[model samples]
Every structure is written in C-alpha cells, then in structure tokens.
Target: MNRRMAVPEQPLLRVRNVSKIYGRSCGECMEGTGPERESNICPKCGSIVAGGPISFDVYPGEILCIVGESGSGKSTLIKSLYFDDTFSSGEVYLQNYEEGKTNLLALSSQKKRRVRNCLMGMVYQNPQLGLRLDFTSGGNNAEKLLTADWHHVGKIRERAQELLARTEIPIERMDDCPKNFSGGMQQRVQISKALANNPSLLLLDEVTTGLDVSVQARVLDLIRQIQRTLGITMIVVCHDFSVIRMLTNRTLVMKNGRVVEAGLTDQILEDPQHEYSQILINSML
Candidate 1:
C-alpha cells in the first residue's frame, strides 16, 4: 500500500521578481545589463539596475544567506526587502500576514510599519543604522516593543533585561548608552532590540563587517544562538562567504544585480556550478 506524503511547509516569506532601479528605466535595463554585460548599468538608458528580477523563498526557522561582492546588489536586495528602499517592481508576501496572499509592497505606509514592527526585524551592518547611540541599550529594546504595542513599563524593562542577557550583553549594562559600548556590544544591543517583538523573520545586512575578528566571531555565535533558541527565520546579506558558511542553511550568490547561483551552503561552497560562483568560491580559498 502506498502512503500519503506530507505536504510541503509553506515559506515564511516569499519574494517574486523583485527589482530596484535607480534613474529612469528604459525597459531594456534588465535585458541590457547584468553579469553577462559585466555591469549593472544599462547601456541604452544609463540607469543602474541595482537589484532584481530576483526571487526566493525563506522557510520558517531557516537561515538564508545572500553573498556577493560589493556592487553585486546583495545590499540593495536586502534593503528592498526591509523597505529601506522601495523596489521598482515585484511582490513580497509573508505567510504570517494575510496567509501570504497580500503583496506587501502594495500595503500603505502605516500598514507596512505595522508589519515591520510586528512581523519582521532588521539589523544593519552599521550599528548606527540599527541603533540610536544615545538611547540606553534597554531603551532601544523598549522602543521596538512599544512600536509593537507593548505597554506596561515593568514588563518592558523585564523583557529588555532578558533580551540583553540572551544576546550576551551584560545585564548591568542595559541602562548604559550603546554609544559607549564596544562595537560587538553595540551589535548585541541592536540584535536584542530587533528581537524585542520576537519577530518571525529577521534580516541582517553585513552585520559582522568592520568588527575585529574576535568580535565578529562572538557576534556570529550570538546570532546562531538566537536563531536556535527562538526558531526565527533569517535572511542574511554579506559579501563574506565564511559568514554564509557559518550561519546559513542555503545560499544565494548574487552579481550584477542578479542571483547567479543558489543552493545548500555546503554544496555551493564545495562545487559551485556558475562561473561567477566558482570564481567567488575560489577567491575565498
């Protein structure tokens, strides 16, 4: 007797044909540019196609990494997903929102803000972008919680302490300003704040960049720990393949505003098929 197979799990987040363009598009922009053309610039329209026609799905509790060289559009793709910059075209759906039937891009600003505060979190490469240096570490966490409709000061403070401890930020330092903390500590605080609402999805962009090697290791470990403990889905963008290997289950190699290759992290690292991916992997070696 044949047995019924289990249904595939729905993606926590789905992105379709997303693209971001700078300057007036000429329709031929995508056609005329990319890794094939050795540029993200359109020869005909002089517009930069910073990202797109990119698509992917992130499953629940999975860590997906987008790895690329500078100008490869990895950063643009991440920023677009976070709504830091509007995409010129494409659709994004979250399984937690409207059963993944709604195009998030079509939502009003207020609705988008609610989605960000309630369903998603972002950690930028520069701690300054994710943190208000002058705010005490605990205050930063409270701000996120408040945006997510968290009231009650005592509960907020307690939650802040818990998150700070989870991220390995000393509980004693929760009331101190992040501006005075070391680079790693500031990132820990940022991570705590992003996790304040226990978002189902977290986006991290070059998070360990510019940190000392030891500090980067600690931060990376903290990220892994958080994901394991919280079971949060994550999309991480970075130029560093090592970081991808360390944290991601799947990987996308992007170049010239396009995804050149994607697969399990170990598979891509060991036997990349795309020429660009091969070059990238070789360079890392």
Candidate 2:
C-alpha cells in the first residue's frame, strides 16, 4: 500500500518583514529600532518606525489578536495592512489574491482599492472613521455594497437589512443616521457595514473601545457569533488582554514596533515568556 502525504493548509494571509517608516531612513533604521533597542525611532536618521519587520500568518477562519500598550505600533500595523498608511517595506500576500504570488504593498492604488472592497473589511476604533455619520445605517451599508458593485437597489436593501439584523441593530432604525444612534449602536452599524461584502478577512482595531462594559460585552458576543457562523478570519488589534483572551485563538505581543511574543492565546496568557508580555498580563490582573 502506498501512502500519500497530506497537503498542509496555506495561510489565508501572509506577512513578512513588513515595516512602516515615517521619515527618510539612514540604512540603519531597522538595526537601530526594536524591542531590544527600546525605541521605534532611529537615532541616526530621526525616522519614526511606526511598525515592522513584523511577520505573521493568519490561517483561514482563525482569530488573531495583537496586543500592546499605546505607541506599541499594533494599530499602525493593522492600518498599514489595510493600506490606510503605506508601509515602507515588506511583503504581504493574500492566498486568494493573485494566487498569493503578488506582494500587496506593490499593487497599484486601483488594485488596492479592489482588494479593500472585495476581500477585506475594517472596523475602526472610532465609528466616524468607518461610517458616514449623516447617512442612514442602511445607507452606510449600501455604500459598501455599492463599492463592491451591488447595483440593484432592492437586493442591496435586502442584504443591508440582513446584515443590520445580524449585528443586532433594529430594522426600524435602518433609516436613522449613525450620528443619531448611541455609541454602541453606531459600532453595530459599523460592523454591519464592514460585513456588507462578506469579506474573507476582517480587521478590527479596538472596535469595543469607549463603549460601556455591558455594551462592549454585547458587541463582543456579536463578533464571536459572526465568526462562528461565517468562518471569517479576523485580525484584532486591542490593548486589553481580557478582550484578546475572549476573542482570539492566537495572540501576538508587540512592543516598540516589534513582536516580542507569539503563541496560542491561552498559553501566552497563562505563561508569557517575554518581559513586556509578562508586564502586560500582570497589568490585566
């Protein structure tokens, strides 16, 4: 009997040595900045290394969390992944995009727009960034669908209604502007809008920040439900360990624009190996 080897699953998203620099580099930028250097700024060139040499793989349907204090560059890393801010160097590949042969950062603006609209979704910490304050909640979702080429008004409306309901928004409030809704409601609307296209990957950057504790719990529960039902991969950037523990299957601990630790979420929480990760876990208690 001949036995064949099983093929390994490919990552849905792959990032390698990705870095975003804010100023001109002195050729020693990476060498001078990182966790060991205790800084994200290059002393020789005065460049702010917002993030990178960051490398990680996100498997399909897995929820990965990036945790760090303010200025740890976790948010910057997520934003760069979405092309909200251009990264200075590195390769990013999506398995479904160009067969993972193309580096996303090298794509043209038009192609990047296509990727953003079709393959990926983002939920920002602030609803204002993700939603049109003056547009009706349904209208905001329609805008996203429209970008993805959903032209039929009736079908668009139907999809919008479905998403709103899924996110626990009242169907009657579909016509209401996000600005008029409570913060938690606004975030729910944002989530619905981001999910309008049924993106393969979702990027959530502190989505529960600033909400009441109970509201946060509801929102987090909604997210968990969505992931369970849709099997969508997610990369969540959050400073709170509790949120990370609640949501992520795996975790990355970042400091000074670099990842200091990466492992199973429960394992990392139970026994953080890095000093900064230990400090973070301690602070959570």
Candidate 3:
C-alpha cells in the first residue's frame, strides 16, 4: 500500500512572544506588560530581560535573514532558538519535527538535543565556537554524525568525506586539523560539519563576519550554492545588507530585541518602513 504523509500548512519554524531575561526579577517585572514590551531592564523590578517577546516565522526552502547591529539581541535570538540559552517565556514551534509542532521552549534538554540534531543545523560567527580546531576536518564532520547515532566507523568516515567534498574541502586535507587552514577554509569546515546530518532547518550566525571582502563574497557564493541545492529552510543572522540581498528571500529586521521590520528582501532594501531600517539603508547608500 502506498501511503501519503500529512503535511502541515504552517511555517517550518515559528516563534511567538519569545523572551529571554538575564537577571532575576521581582514578581512585578513582566507583570501587566507582555511580549510587546521591549528593552531588557525592567525599571520597576531591576530585572534584565535580554531579549524578546520576539516573533517571526521561517518557511520551508526559504532563506530568512535577521539583520541588526551589535548588541541588538540578534545573537540572543539565535542562541535561544537552538536552546543554547534559556528563555524566560515564549513559544517556539518547529513544523518539521517528527513529534509534531512543539514549542521548543517547552522541550526537555534531551528532547531539545534530539530535535537540534535531526531538524536543525547552526554555523556560528566564529569557527572556534563551532569547530574543534584539534580535530581533523573530516573528524569534525564525524562528530556531528556520531551525535545523530551513526555508529559504523567506516560509514561515518565515508559520510564525512562526502560532506567535506560538497563544501569544497580538499580530500587530501580531510585528515588535517582546522588550525592549519585559513579563516575561510575553517568556516567551510564548520559548514561541512553543520550539514553532515542534512538538517531541515539551518541557522547561520554571522558566518562571514571577519573575512576579507573578496573572501566574504566567495563564502557567500558557497552558501548560496548549498541553499539552492538543498532547498533547506534557513535563518541567517547578519548585519551586512549584501549578505541579506544575495542570500535571502525574506528578512526580519531586529533592533533593541524586537522585530522592527519584516518583508520581501527587495522591499526592505528599497522601501524600509522602520526608522532603524531606514538608517541602515541610508548608511549603505
């Protein structure tokens, strides 16, 4: 019997009124107020609400960019989505998870990890944070495979070779530690590792931050190639407009831990409505 699977008519990922607070609050800090309330510190209770009640959705096969200056809570949102940091209150739902739509904020640590391994992938701004320099390039990829329960040593190495090749890593250098590669090569290794499991949703956090301009363009091209081939849902955290313009179809502009503007990539570039967004465009021009 041929069985058809049921598909959800919801976004691949969704976040509703998400908030991450850093400091302990008295009972009244978030009282009366809600997700609409921004700015981390509570004047009333002296609690630091570092991020959110932020809201946004990522669709399947769409590249969604999050753009903001430093300390605008963009990083916080990225970390929170992956469960690297705790959120004070919110609901996050991932549609592709086999378990059905679940508020990621409510998942247990073990459950969250399984979800991360199966449904999500992340490449951080710094390779040091994502790739273990001590491990060979292929070994790094093996680590990701192992996380997903691939126990056959030979099969794991074969998968690692395929990922490294896909990301343009030299097969001969697969056994060399990332410490010997240039910055761009190191980032490529990180990308290779991140995609080892073929995750449905990929999160890129400032992946091109410190590379030279030419190298940055090349890295972006590689990312675009991967996105086109995989058609995976992506949430890219970046401040560069060129990155947003080249890689994404939709974008969410964040400031002070809130989504100030959101729309088509061109609309945001040509006709930004929010004041902060205007400033970003103006400076670009």
Candidate 4:
C-alpha cells in the first residue's frame, strides 16, 4: 500500500497591531446657551480616539471570517491588509516566493502594487465598483491581460467563460454588460474577474450584503465551494453569523472596533466567553 505524505501548512498571511484613524474631528461648539456639542472623542472615553489594531493569521487553504457590525473595523482591517489605506501602526507579513515571510507594510508602493494583483484577489462590497460597468463581462475579465504577460485574448476569453460557468452564470451572458444583469449576477461576474488572477489568497468584504436573502445563501454556498475547489486561503468580512458558520471553521468577533473573541466557530457560537460576544449572540436570537 502506498502512503500519501502529509502536507505542511505555511502561514500565508499574518497581521499584527494594524490600525487606521480618520483625521476628522468634531468642530467647536456653538453658543454656550445651547447644549455642549457632542465631542467626537473616543466613545470609550474622552481620550483621543486611537483607531483599533487587528491581529490574526490566515493559514493555507483556510477560511477566516472577520465578523462585526458596521464601523466595527471589519472593512478597515481588510483595506489595510490590502494596502488600500495607510496603516498607522503594525505589520503585515506575507509568504514570499523565496519561502520566507515578508512584511507587506515594509514594501514600497510599486512592490505593493505588484504583490496586490498577483498574490492576492479582493472582492469589494460593490461588484460594479470593482469592474468597468461600460465594458462587457468578457471584456472586463480580459482587461487584466493588459497588465500581465498573457496578452492572448483567446485564452482570457476561455478562462473567463470557465470562471463564469464556475459561478453558475451562463457563458452566453459573456457579451452582456454588468449593468444589464441583476445584482446577484453582477456579483458573480465580479467573482469571475477576481479569479482571473488565480491568486493564492482572496479577500472578500461583505460581498453578499446587498443581495436578497435567497441570493445571499446562493452566493455564500458558491464561495464555500470555490474555496474548497481552488484551495485558496480566504479572509471574509461579514456581519451575518449564518454565512460565517456555513463557510468558516474559525471566526473573529469584533465590537466597537476591537476584537472581543477569537476561536473555533462552534466554540465562539456555543460558549462565547466575552461580554460583547455574549450580547451579540443573545441579540442574534
């Protein structure tokens, strides 16, 4: 009997103490007669609002969901991880081609750009925003060919068709514009484009939030299937616990821009230890 060797999993990405702060602050109050203007200071206290830091690791072929309410640092963390915004502090480590961990925060803008498209894929909340609405589905998917050495449109078209098929969208819709499709169809097309790069890690930011309940379930199922079939590490940001439970083995719960709990999904859902997590769970019921 031949024995298959166990595969060793490497840390594909690590984020430590990552934070971002908006510079805007409350303007000065009006006349003293009126109530004191609400200070935009930290809700936790009167002290300066120091943006929260996020710490986590995404392993190879694993799905990690960062769950929180709106403005709870879910999107901020994803944006910082993708280097879309300047992080105030902390480091991001990514597995490099040389089998070493490289600090993504330390990379130059040009280097970061190179890393963003090839090593990682991001699906924004608004699918149409990520794609050129004017372009046909086929054209949008083939657009990446301009940046890559793969200039053959025929190959790009074939790959686009395959991706569309994988997402359960008919290949006949390849020539149609995204504007003509329903929101769910548009999202599927966006996934197709994101997969065009064949990235090892995919970051999804509330990708199904805007869809109907039925469409949301379908989208979540498709995502889980894609992750399993592609063996790609995915970090998803979502507020829906149902979606997280269906797709992820581990979960990170956040409250007021801070991670209140982190552990196996079942444990967190069943025996939540943190006060915030307890409240979140109770409210869900």
Query: What are the clashing pairs of model 3?
Result: none
lDDT of 2 by residue, 202-269 (tens): 99999999999999999999999999899889999998888887888888999999999998888899
Model 4, which residues run further than 4 Å from truth?
1-9, 24-40, 43-51
Q: Per-residue lDDT tens digits of candidate 3, residues 16-86? A: 99987767777565552332454556778777655667888777778888888776788888888887888
**RMSD (Å) per prediction:** 3.5, 4.0, 4.8, 6.2
Alpha carbon deviation, residue 103, candidate 1 (Å): 0.5
* Per-residue lDDT over 21-138 for candidate 4, one digit per residue giving the tens place of the 0 to 100 score: 5553232111111102222244432332223566888787778889866656678788777777777668888876345466778888988887887777788899866788889988
lDDT for each candidate structure: 0.91, 0.92, 0.83, 0.74
* Poorest stretch of ten by lDDT in candidate 3: 1-10
Measured with C-alpha atoms, the lDDT of residue 245 in candidate 1 is 79
- Candidate 4 has which clashing residue pairs, if any? none
Alpha-carbon error at 180 in model 2, in Å?
A: 0.4
Q: Write the per-residue lDDT of candidate 1 for residues 1-285, one digit (tens) a residue.
A: 011222248989999999999999999999999999999999998999998899999888888899989999998888888888899999999998999999999999999999999999999999999999999999999999999999999999999999999999888898999999999999999999999999999999999999999999999999988887788889999878788778888889999999999888888998999999999889986
Identify the runs in model 1 with alpha carbons over 4 angstroms from their true place.
1-8
